[model samples]
Target chain A: MGKIALKRTSLYASGASPVNLLQARFYNEDCLVYDLEDSVPVQEKDAARLLVYNLVKYQRPVGKYVIIRVNGIYSEYIDEDLEAAVRACPDAIRIPKVEHAYEVQKIAKRISEIEKAAGIEEGSIELWCNIESYLGVLNAREIAESDPRVVALALGAEDFTASMKAARTKASLEIFYARNAILMACRAAGVEAIDAVFSDINDVEGLKEDVKLTRNLGFDGKTVVHPRQVDVVNAAFTPSKKEINYALRVLAAVEEGKRQHKGAVTLGGDMIDKPMELRAQTTLAQARAAGINV
Target chain B: MALNIKQTAVAGTMESSDVMVTVKPAEGQGLVIHLQSNVLTTFGDQIRATVQEVFSDFGIRDAEVFLVDKGAIDCVIRARVQAAICRASGEGFNWKGEDK
Candidate 1:
């Protein structure tokens, strides 16, 4: 995964809902995660699998990262889920409730076999792990470092809070440790960290603040349920005009310093060093990715 | 093997998010399709094309497909029809190794 643009909003559409899936492809979500795990009924899994496979094959998700959230490794349907997901040939596979490195390894092994047998270019499909449990948060680093195919680690708040016997709130003070742990592990492992979904669709203001918190907490983006929340997440991740201007100034200062043969320069009474310049460059990159004319 | 719908069967939901497909044995020759859709005028041709492709893939010579579509695309429509047909004809779904 060499420098793929991160989706500011990854909207999940039920793979079983053909109507929704079709409609979702037209939406402006940067990433559309077609879910086959919790959304599809146990009985409909087989049929839904085929439906997702065909949809991915036929539908060209232009300018969107198409990811299929396959069933958990422990589930009986995981084999079938991986088979359909790989054959569908989505851009990525999001493994739910990944608690151990072995889970990532297992999925990688299956993806490799399927890619070869199906004649897909090897390593073309990426992997995303979901840190949804206490164990998952604890072993997030190992799971993230499990394979090169793992590009992003998403936090599943509903399951994590349930596992910890804590209530999930709009303020989200409960899953603080879980979020931080995953974020730190991802940063250490050099993978993207995505925040969890905000379930209350009616509470727009609450969602706004939640997106702000995720962005403030260093998450790259959020996992959203409805299409309406896409823009909110996108705006939250995109660099503001003021921020972009400041970043530009910092880079200018760095260039000036290099021209003068000075070791460094200061901005806002703080040293504008390598790390700060890198952060500024990243902000500009993010602005570019979000289509903001920085 | 020329397969025919043995009974009337429905798969999927009529909800706004899903598509409902109903299949039954055809009383007359050829395929009869009565498509009820919200985007009937705009997407009618596409819907008919999708249903035709599914029927051709399954080798069904005669069947009546009554689709109450809630804006389902080709993929969901294909799955619902396949499931409904499998149920109507009393056959198992071997949905593996069919990917091209």
Candidate 2:
């Protein structure tokens, strides 16, 4: 298949725990990310890597997007991590701490070598670059446009906030600029952008509010850590009932305008042109993909 | 290849339903197992049997396995032991999640 569909909920589970792995695979998260970065302890990295490799190679996560979060590009474990990652044939490889375009290029090179050696197709595995550092946020556009294998850009809010020496608040005003910049870069590159995880998992209301912010920010999806958070994510990514109705009306108006041989149309006293029609079409498509009854 | 312990290696954690398996070279003629588990009273023999089964599968004849179990299941115990033995045998790229 082409690059895996952008899932609304990307769940990050600990690679060291098989129970967590099973949960993530069976859960509602459309994307399952086996995290070998921060979740695994230093000494347990090998164990986690082995388990993740086995899960990717031996077992099939049917109806799920399987991704691996390897160590940071500059970390010591990336080489070994990618060795298993490429051979395992996961849908994607998520690289953390991506500050420059060269990082993605280097990973793409390594993946190319592994694909040849493993007899897998080159560029089969997609790359998701996580922007966490100040430089990463600054060079988000370059990183997004770095390589074709780099299909998605992730906002690593905790690390970004720490790097900026800014505090996270209920409103999250500190990292607003970074989020907007990353999303803008992804838009320019024609790639998907994922929102960061809501660390306060118990606060369902907070998660709902956070997801609304992400949706308004034009994020393709949200990254969640807990299984319970998937529902909120899926709901947030879906176009609401009101949006679907408006989109349908807009499309009908566009169709009428087309039949009348008129390029310009009006809907609800507002000018409806090609751009608005395209936006409406996209909204309806998203709602359909989300299984909404629109 | 026969499984031979080259160094001391440990795998697993102290979390609930987890096990920490440590392996070292055995000076004796065969494998020796020391297990600590919450269900030891009823399942001690079964757990030891499972460890021995894994050892036999790997063709390990001389090694000391120290199993610290926190109610881990059979598959997890097997994986932990497999990881520990792989590390102990100085297996390259195995611990890094590579095939062979």
Candidate 3:
């Protein structure tokens, strides 16, 4: 299958929790992250790995992109996590606390080895690096372009704020630079950029505002901790009806101009240039991904 | 394929669509299973068959398996059983050999 272009929301389900893992696929999010990192306690790591492996292999969720968030690269459990996760054949393996390009390369190399040993196609599994520290933000560009398997870079705001010794707020002013830095890196590398999770699950209004900011800042998606946040983020990322209509009209105008052999395509008395055409195409693509007819 | 059951271990929970499985070294008991499920009367034979299949796949001849089911399906039952057996055996799973 082809890659998913519009991943509006990636929902995190604790790997150790059977109920959550079973129900994760039914949610409206574009991606499902079976997390074995911070969400699983140290004692349950082994059990969680086994559970996630079975769930991914036998009862693999359909219609949604599945990713397994392994432990940190330097941790003792990383090798085992990769061994199980790679064999499980999730769409991607999320590496936490990535600060350099070499880390991604090394992990990708190990993933290749596992794939070969398991008889799975090499490079079939992808990677998602989590940038949670100041150094990670600084080296974001190199990390995003580090390896071909690296498909996305996600900002880990809770840890990033802690690393900077700054407080996390609803306004998210503290990690503004990190967010933009990751976004810029992803854009430059032609990969997707996923925003951090909105920690406060109860504040629906706050989550809506945060999602709006996430979309306005040009993020491809957001990581949601709670199931309730999925629809809000998905809705915010999906193209609105009015925007879809304008994109359709812009494409039609371009086609008409091509048929007439005109120098420039004008939509509603305004010239539609390259950037506008590209934006219109992207809007329609996103609409299509969200299941809109147009 | 030989796993030594060194300790008693438990996996899973009593939540809806989940089953809590506990495995213990039964020495000479030869694969005994005590199961309690809300849907026991409806799915009793199928659940037992699933548990027996997991133990047979693991090459276990003797063990005490206790399961509390809350309407878990076949896959969930298999996962929880494997988790409990692995934990009790104090060994990492051989994914290639046992996962099929």
Q: How close is candidate 1 at the interface, in terms of C-alpha RMSD after superposing the true interface residues?
A: 2.5
Q: Report the C-alpha lDDT of model 3 over B1-100, residue by residue, as the tens digit.
A: 7686678999888888889999999898798999999889999999999999988888898999999999888888888898899899987777667323
- What TM-score against the true fold does each predicted structure earn? 0.88, 0.87, 0.93
Candidate 2 structure lDDT: 0.85
Off by over 4 Å in 2: A1-3, B1-3, B14-19, B27-61, B64-79, B95-100
Index of the highest-TM-score prediction: 3
Order the candidates by TM-score, highest first: 3, 1, 2
Q: Per-residue lDDT for A60-117 in model 1, tens only?
A: 4777898999888999988878877888788899999999999899889989998888
Query: Relative to the true structure, how large is the alpha-carbon lDDT of every model?
Result: 0.86, 0.85, 0.91
Per-model TM-score (chain A alone): 0.95, 0.96, 0.95
What's the TM-score of chain B for every model shown? 0.89, 0.87, 0.94
What overall lDDT, based on C-alpha atoms, would model 3 receive against the true structure?
A: 0.91
Error of 1 at A96 (Å): 0.9
Clashing pairs in 2: none
Error of 3 at A37 (Å): 1.5
